[model samples]
Target: MASAIPLTRADMKRLADYAKREGVKAEVQIDDFIFRVSADHPPAKVDGSEESELDRELMEFDRKHGYR
Candidate 1:
């Protein structure tokens, strides 16, 4: 098994600052006693087809489940 690695407060602060500058959101998770950080943002909506496909799928699912 791998060992846990510890980070200083300065390191965490730097990461958060960088994320804010880049317009990214940060997520932190804990596994057992370990902590991890992740940054994410909404993916670029490529084109109309991609968005239309998503909407179509949602509409179909809703119709199937009687959510509409």
Candidate 2:
């Protein structure tokens, strides 16, 4: 298991400043100093045809039951 690291006020301020300067949003994880910065935009939509294993199985079941 990973240990969590506490961030000081200065550290948080610096990170916030950097994120603001870069014009992105920061997602910080305390357990692993992982920062995920993304632009302030809508997330991309997934294609409808890209089905997961569970989705495929459910579709097969539906077809067998003539529920389509």
Candidate 3:
């Protein structure tokens, strides 16, 4: 039995376009899409300022408690 795709036309179009561009079939790829959406992916970088703060925090943490 064929399953119904719950995605909207625009979403399917975007998926189809992306799949075509990447040379992949857009056939029932909802699982992969859902997995990617559900995963705990990292946040995107906006500015370079966060890098320095992160580095400083990491160094302070290491100094406070020795690195394993």
Candidate 4:
């Protein structure tokens, strides 16, 4: 049972506007004086077309160290 904080109309509108600009879903929750805001966004995709030099070196090191 957490404490909840009361937010004014202006505060709510500001938060909503921020969420809209970020292109993410916003969630707000209040519990016993606590106000929480969270954003949900998809994970970024990685390019795997070619192995970088550092990647190749790390792989070689892992093979030598017997790190599966």
Query: What lDDT score belongs to each candidate, Candidate 1 first?
Result: 0.71, 0.74, 0.63, 0.68
Could you tell me the TM-score of candidate 1? 0.34
- Model 2: how far residue 51 lies from native, Å: 40
lDDT of 4 at 21: 75
Deviation in angstroms for 63 in model 1?
A: 0.4
Model 2 Cα lDDT, one tens digit per residue, 1-68: 75555776677778777777787788788665765555455577977677576699999999999999
Instruction: Kindly list the per-residue Cα lDDT of model 4 for residues 28-58, writing each as its tens digit.
Output: 6555444344455669876664447679888
Give per-candidate clash totals: 0, 0, 0, 11
lDDT tens per residue, model 1, 1-68? 87554656887788777776777755555455443445566687789998899999999999999999
Better of 1 and 4 by TM-score: 4
Cα deviation of 47 in candidate 4 (Å)? Answer: 0.6
* Candidate 4 TM-score, C-alpha based: 0.37
Clashing pairs in model 2, backbone N/Cα/C closer than 3 A: none
lDDT of 3 by residue, 1-68 (tens): 66566687787677667765665554554553431122233577677688888988999999889873
Backbone steric clashes in candidate 3, count: 0
TM-score winner between candidates 1 and 2: 2
Which window of ten consecutive residues has the lowest lDDT sum in model 1? 28-37
